[model samples]
Target: MNTYKQIEAEILAASNILITAHKSADGDSVGSSLGLLHFIEKLGKKATICHPDKAPDFLDFLDLSHIITMDQEPEKVNTAFQEADLIFCLDYNSTDRVGKDMTPLLESASCTKIMIDHHLDPQDFASITVSDTSASSTAELIVELIELSENGSLLDEKIGTPLYVGILTDTGSFRFNSVKPRTHEVLAILLAGGVKHYMIHEMLNDTNTASRLRLQGFAMSEKMEILDVNSVAIISLTKGELEKYQYKKGDTDSLANLALSIKGMKVAIVLSERDGIIKISFRSKGKVNPVNALAANHFDGGGHANAAGGMCELSMDETLDKMKALVPEYFPVQ
Candidate 1:
C-alpha cells in the first residue's frame, strides 16, 4: 500500500501524461481511466487515455471515444508515448494484460510509470505501484486518490460518473461478495457529486443491442453446461459462434450471472475464444477460489476469491477437458 502523498507528488510532477488500461477494456478499466483523466486534467496537466482496442458499445457512453485504439499506426500512438512525462497504468497490474502490441512502448517509455491496480500479480515496470486487491475496484481507489489530492474539492459530475460506473460493474451492481461499507461510502459521495443514478444504470444495463441480446439467448440455450450434479456450471463461446451471431464486444459480460441463477451451483465458469486463445472468467458462490485452481494448472491469471480470470492456449475441446479434469479436484463430494 503506497502512501497518497507519494502518489500525489508523482502526479504533480508529471506534465504530459498517458493513461492506459488492459486490452479488451471492461468496466473497471474504462471507468478507472476516465475517472483518472478528469483528475489529471483538473490538476492543469495534459492527459490522454489510450486502449489496446475500442471499448465496448455499452461503455462508449464514457468520453473515451477519441482515445487511440490499438489498430492505429504504432508511430501515431508512440508519438504520444514519446511526448508523455508520465504513464499511468490502471486496473491491470501486468503489462502483458495490457496487450503484447504495447510491449515496445511500455519498455521504451522514458516517462515515469505508475501502476494503480487491484489485480493479484504486480509487475515490476512501475516506478510506483499502488495495488490493493481488497478494494472493490480500481475506480474506488481512484476516488480515494482524488479525495486525498488538492483537487478533492473538484470532484464533479464528469469524474463521478466513471468512478460510479467502475464501482457498479466491479461489484456486480453491489450484489457480489466484494461489496463493503467503504464501497457504500464512495457511492454516497459520488451520488452527492451529481452522478445521475438512472442514467448510469441505463447506460450499463438497459442499452443492449439486438445482436447482443440474440447472442445472449443463443449462448444460454446452446452453450451452457452443468457439471457434477449442478455444483459447477460452464458457458462457452468460440470465435465461429461469436461471428455467426454477430457478437459484439461486451456481449458476454453478464453471462456469468446465469450460473448464479442455479439453485446449488458453487462455481461458474465462462470460457470465450479470443485471438486464438481461450479466456476463462471464474465466479464462485462460497469458499472456493477458482483462481488458485487456474494458476496451478498453467493458466496465467487470478482475481478476487469469488471472481477471477485466466487464459489458456488450448483449443476449445482441450480447454473443456482441462476444466473438467480440474473441477473434481477443487470441489470434492462431501
Candidate 2:
C-alpha cells in the first residue's frame, strides 16, 4: 500500500512549494492543484501554482485567475521553482505533459518532488508517486491526502468548488463508465463541506458564448467526417477557422464526444491546429483503446481506455492519412 506520511512530512518541512499540472490544463489538473494550494496555504506555507498553459474561461470561477498563465513565462517560473523547498505535480504522471517549455524547471527543482495522478502507466519521475487509476479524478486523491494528513476539516468553499469541478468534469457529469458508487460518495462529502454543484455545472456546461456555439455547429456540420464504415468519426478545425469564430477557449472540448451520438460509431477523433501543431483528441467505447493507436503512431499520449489524446507534427491532411492508417489496427472488421 502507498503512504502519504512521507509526503506530509516533506510538506511540513518545506517553507516554499510550487504546484503544477499537465499542459492544456483541464479541470482535473486545475482543480487538484487549487485544492492542494488551499490546503497548503491553510497550513501557513507559501504555495504557488505554475501551469503550462492558461485554463479555460469557465474555470475562471475557481479563483485561479492570477495563477492561470504562469506557465507562459519560463524564466519567471524557473526562479520560483529554484527557490521552492518542494514541488507537487498533480493530475499528471509524466513531466512531458507538464509542458514542454517548463522542462528545465522540472529538471532543476532542487526540492522534494511528489506526483499525484490517476492515469494508467504513470512514468516514474518523482521522489514520491501516488497514483491509482481507479480513482475518478486527481482531486479525489487530493481529498484523500488531506484527510490522511488530518486536514479534511480544513476544507472551505474555495477549495471545495475546484475539487467538485474536477470530479464533475472527469466523470462526464457522472455519466462516464468510470462513475462508480464511491465517486458519488466522495461528491456527497464535498457537497457537505459546502461545495456548490449547480455553479460548477453552469460554469462547465451553461457558459458557452455565441461564437463557441457557432463553432460547434460548424464543426458538427462541415468538419466532421465519418470513416471505416462509421466506426471512426474525425473532426478537424484550423486555427484560422477558430479565430474567425472568435473562439475563446475550451470551445472544442466536446467535439470528439459529439461524434459519439452517432449510432454504431465506436471511436471519435478531434484534430485541431494550435500554434502550428496538430492536437488530437481520441475517444473510444468498449474494447477500443485509442491510446494504443496513438502510441503506435509515434505520438506520445495516453489516457483511459474510453478517452485518450496525442499530437502530430504533420499538417492536417498528413495527420489524417496517418490516423486513417493507424486507427483500423485497433478497430478491426466485425
Best by lDDT: 1
Off-target runs (Cα >4 Å) in candidate 2 are: 66-71, 228-230, 289-297
Against the hidden true structure, what lDDT does model 2 obtain? 0.81
Q: How high is the CA lDDT of each candidate model?
A: 0.83, 0.81
Question: Which portions of model 1 miss their true places by more than 4 Å?
Answer: none
Provide the lowest-lDDT 10-residue window in model 2. Answer: 288-297
Per-model TM-score, in order, reads 0.94, 0.94
Q: Candidate 1: lDDT of 253?
A: 80
lDDT of 1 by residue, 1-334 (tens): 2477677777788878899898777889889899888877878878888788888778888976657876665666777788889899998888777788886787788778989988775778898888988889999999999887766888989989999999999988998877889999988889888899789998788897888888889888899899855388899899999998888778888888877667887888899998789988888776654444565355777777778778899999999998888777776664
Q: How far is each candidate from the true structure, as Cα RMSD in Å?
A: 1.9, 1.8
**Candidate 1: pairs in clash:** none
Clashes of 2: 0
Candidate 1's TM-score reads 0.94
